[model samples]
Target: MTPHNELRLLPWSGPDGKPCFLLSTDGPLSRLAGLTEAAQLDIAADLLEHAHEVLADESSAPEELRLVPSDLTGALGDALRVAASRGHRLPTPGTSDHGDSNEVPHLPAGAFG
Candidate 1:
């Protein structure tokens, strides 16, 4: 179990559309949340690829183009939620647990280009 102040951010929202959280790190609910997060990431990846394809096609209809933004928006939301959840779980810098390795490795400029 984590400390009271260190609740794990859940991947899904509550009935009121507010964020949910996990207090303990074990049990069925935690496992379900992990699975849900993985599924959300997978869906977001697929949606991103599909969005690129749709945008790159010059002949795509206006209706098709319009739909892509809505889908992308949902995917982006899911991705941001996942990131926040995972980020909260990372060991803080200078902690003996993970040491000072919390810094993300720098990518070369234009690595994605």
Candidate 2:
């Protein structure tokens, strides 16, 4: 069994659309993991381009305008996950020890729900 404490960044999401992660000791990246990461980055890149285009369009619909923020934010989060998987550890939000006591507020469970 995979060790419970060994960290692994998940490349896909749960059935409810939430991101999922795993725990496994130092092992080679699985074929599925590699493929998933590539696919996710590709999709994110496409979405980013689409989001920029939507923002640039003078005649964008109200719905498209509303989508821009969520789309961009989601892409950024995905990119962060990919970066984390490559061994760049992101500091835990509230654990920053720079004497800044203002904790970053956690977002509500769902996006704009």
Candidate whose lDDT is highest = 1
**Model 1 CA lDDT for position 19:** 87
Clashing pairs in 2: none
Residue-wise C-alpha lDDT for candidate 1, range 1-113, written one tens digit per residue: 34456889998899999988888888899899899999999999999999899889999999999999999899899899989988888755444344445565568989988
Those runs of model 2 whose alpha carbons end farther than 4 Å from true positions after fitting are: 1-6, 13-29, 88-113
Per-residue lDDT tens digits of candidate 2, residues 6-39? 4666776789987676655334655577677788
Candidate 1 residue-wise lDDT at 68 = 92
lDDT of candidate 2? 0.72
TM-score of 2: 0.56
Worst 10-residue lDDT window for candidate 1 reads 93-102
Model 1, clash count?
Answer: 0
Would you estimate the TM-scores of all the predictions?
A: 0.79, 0.56
